[model samples]
Target chain A: MTDYIVPVLLFAACAVALRKKENAYDLMLLGAKDGLKLLVSLIPTLILLLTAVTMLRASGAMEMLSRFFAPAFSVLGIPPETAILVLVRPISGSAALALGADLMAQYGVDSLVGQTAAVMLGSTETTFYTISVYFGAAGIKKTRYTLPAALIADITGFVVASLTVRLFL
Target chain B: MVMSWIFTGLLALSLFASLVLGNGSALAAAVPQGARDGVNLVLSIAGSICLWSGVGKLMEVVGFTGFLSKLLSPLLHRLFPSTRQDKDLGQSLSANVCANFLGLGNAATPMGIQAAQRLAKRSEGIASDELCRLIVLNTASIQLLPANVAAVRVSLGCQTPFDILPAVWITSLCSASLGLCAAWLLGKVWRR
Candidate 1:
């Protein structure tokens, strides 16, 4: 089902273009060129943000912070060991994946922490990364309430992920 | 402005923590490594981004986007009233949401950027309420399939990788709903 999505969309697009007598190839090229420009603009933002996140992880600061927050997180029903996954999920996808994989390896994939980590990774987005890319491409600097609201969503995701794993799994 | 402060704080805290923990050398190495990783990530998704953007253009030219926006307009208009006034923005937002629904992150980003660009047009540098809602929607991640998580679970020898589908669905819907509500409340309170 997932595999057919792109092809189906493209087929529909082409069929429409053919019916409408539009020059689909030229329009596609024009759009691709615009995409390239957007990609170039996003490079600096991605590099800088990724570097900061990576540095935070590599310096063990993320682990330290996770440890600091573990007790509070546990009160919310999130396992203390999965605290790093919760913290990193909103900041960076790759880092969260790494942490999730590590948790699964350490605790076994069937364990409560492992399943919770998987569910959390599945459900949450890297808020900082997504915000930076979208806003940076448009050159918008003041995000206003986006970050706080997104964080609220993320915290909800983390909590719900744990609860669902406990109830269903 | 706030983003800059967060970025600075992250760097400052990382450097401070590394120095205190005697991990400065590792931190120094991670900077370059991270830049490389970022470039690699971009390279990986570049083709898909361009492809989707091209497809998006084709869709727009062929009026497929119009059809999509019309199909989704009822819900979209309620979430983003600006879409009712701006047809193009509606198309872009619909495309972004569709891509996200399919779990096509690479495709979603470019379409999302297009929508963000449209939403940013009226606001003078600061993000508008609609733009904030768009970000919240994307950050909440309402995707049909958790392919990445399933892949990791499969590699780690989980017998039923997709068993968590229901949980994923529940969490995603809840988070997106909560995020949108928060954005709406915040927008109402912080109206300037």
Candidate 2:
């Protein structure tokens, strides 16, 4: 079902273009070029972020911090084991993916903890990364209430993810 | 300013922790490994991003994005009142949300940035309420497919990866709704 979505969307777009007698091929090339430019501009930020997060993970700081936060998080129905995932998720996407993969591996993927971790990963975004990139591009110096609100949302996602998995999965 | 602090703090804290935990060597190795991984990640997504961007351009030319904007206008009009007066911004926001819903992170970012730029025009170097709300919307993760999570589950030997869809949906809806409400409430309070 999910696999069909992409192809279906593409087909619809192409059909529309043809009906409108638009030069679809040339426009696609132009957009692709713009995409390449966008990726090039994003490279530095992505590399720096990934490096810092990887260092933190490799040095075991994430594990240590997760251990400290485990009790608090457990009160919210999040298991102690997935504490690192919840922590890393808001800051880094790849790091969170790695942590989620590790959780599913350590516990069987069918286990409650693993299922909860997956749901959490699926439901939440990398808050810090999104905030920084979007605001930075807009040259907004004062983020005002964005960070607090985003963090609140993230916490809501994490807590609800655990509960949903527990009740449904 | 905040981003700078976060980047520096992440590096400083990691270095301090590595020295104390006797994992300095691992930390050293991870830096280059991570840089390589970042490049690889970009390369891996490049094809899809280009493809989607191309398709998105076609959609734009054919006015499909306008149709999408209208389709979602009732909710969007409230969330982004500026969209009612600014057609371009509305199209960009709709495109971004559509890409995000399909879990196309690469395609979403450019469109999101475009929308953000337009929103920023009304502010004086500070994020307006609408701009902040847009950021919140993006950060709340409203993806419907969650393909990446399902793939990871499949690799981990889960027979039915999509079984968690209901849980994902519930969590996403809850988070996005709560996040938007929090942003709106905070905006109201801060204005006082």
Against the true structure, whose TM-score is highest?
Answer: 2
What lDDT would candidate 1 get against the real structure?
0.80
Off by over 4 Å in 2: A1-67, B1-68
Q: Which stretches of candidate 1 lie over 4 Å from their true place?
A: A1-67, B1-71
The TM-scores that each candidate's chain B achieves against the reference are 0.66, 0.68
Task: Give per-residue CA lDDT, model 1, range A57-129, as digits (tens).
Answer: 7888867877888889878999888876676677766656656765775688899989999999989999988
Clashes of each: 0, 0
The DockQ values of the predictions, listed in order, are 0.46, 0.52
User: Which candidate achieves the best lDDT against the true structure?
Assistant: 2
